[model samples]
Target: MLYAILAYHVEDEILSWSPEQDAAVVAKVIEVQAPMRASGLLGPAARLDETRKARTLRGPGAGMVLDGPFSETKEQLLGFHLVDCATDDEAVAAARKLRAVNPSAVYEIRPVKLYVPADGFGTTRG
Candidate 1:
């Protein structure tokens, strides 16, 4: 099974960190991800840029372009990790490892249904 691990954090709090502090936290996260990467259980993962740089569009047709994501939440979606796991428990375990490294952030684990052009747009069987 494939899982999507969504990372959420308070943008303001994260922005308040010094460069060194941010680097240290990122290093810890990388350390936790090392085993999964080596074992080919990890896939694409990324940390999103600040929401200030975001844009949004809603409604019909081309939609009404908006300035930012404007998400109505205290914590913003920060990043995500894709992983291949045998079961939901395995996926939760992976998220737990990440939480151990950065306890402040929240991780949401969800099963993924992947579709690709080469796969004729059919959902890939996990």
Candidate 2:
């Protein structure tokens, strides 16, 4: 199964962490990724640009492409990791290792829902 490990910022994350501190965390991320890769668990990982670069589209017909940064929030998502694990224990272990690398960070580990192809009758079948 696939697990997504989400890391979001907390009160102290942006306020207290300096560039150097952030860099150290990034370095640890690198180390962790190496092990994850060796174990054949890591799928993809990325750090998003500030929310200022975001654009939201409500629907296809509106031609309404909203622009600009999202309203600021305290717990902005920082990044995530996608891991393929055989069991919950393995997924938790990976998340714990990441948490240990950066104690100040918070994470949410969740299972990825498997997608089923839609049946011809306009509905999805299991």
Candidate 3:
């Protein structure tokens, strides 16, 4: 089986929708994600808080993790989805559905590469 990673560099801030509209969007997501999860097609999906809630680590010798998000670009990785799919077309279709709800935001779809050793030791290469 092949899987795709749905990643994105989001704007520094996201616009807020009205309570009623937010409820409706949540309802729609529930309908879609439920079916995909039932079929084992939705491997994983998540939403992250703003960059302000982030912490960064430099290196093994960098000591304690640093506070605050990047002070750099307006783009920050906001969230992602790992999907089990049959082909790139199917992945793109899924991405399109997500984009429909977040038209103003950007979305990216890429293949996920997993390495499983012949001995089946269950170690990840990347």
* Best-matching candidate per TM-score: 1
Least lDDT summed over 10 consecutive residues: which range in candidate 3? 6-15
Worst 10 residues of 1 by lDDT: 115-124
TM-score of 2: 0.72
Q: Which candidate, 2 or 3, would have the higher TM-score against the true structure? A: 2
Structural similarity to truth (TM-score) of each candidate = 0.86, 0.72, 0.66
lDDT of 1 by residue, 1-126 (tens): 899999999999999999999999999999999999999999777899998988888999989988898889888889999999999999999999998999989998999987332433334662
lDDT of 3 by residue, 9-110 (tens): 544334356778657755765566676778888865666667777998876775678886765755666777677788888988877776676565466777
Q: For residues 1-126, what per-residue lDDT tens digits would candidate 2 score against the true structure?
A: 998888777645555779898899889988988988888889777776665567777767776778844647666667888889999889889988988888876788899896343356433553
lDDT of 1: 0.90
How far out, in Å, is residue 94 in model 2? 1.0
Ordering by TM-score: 1, 2, 3
Steric overlap count per candidate: 0, 0, 0
Stretches of candidate 3 exceeding 4 Å from the true structure: 1-15, 62-64, 71-75, 114-126
Clashes of 2: 0
TM-score of 1: 0.86
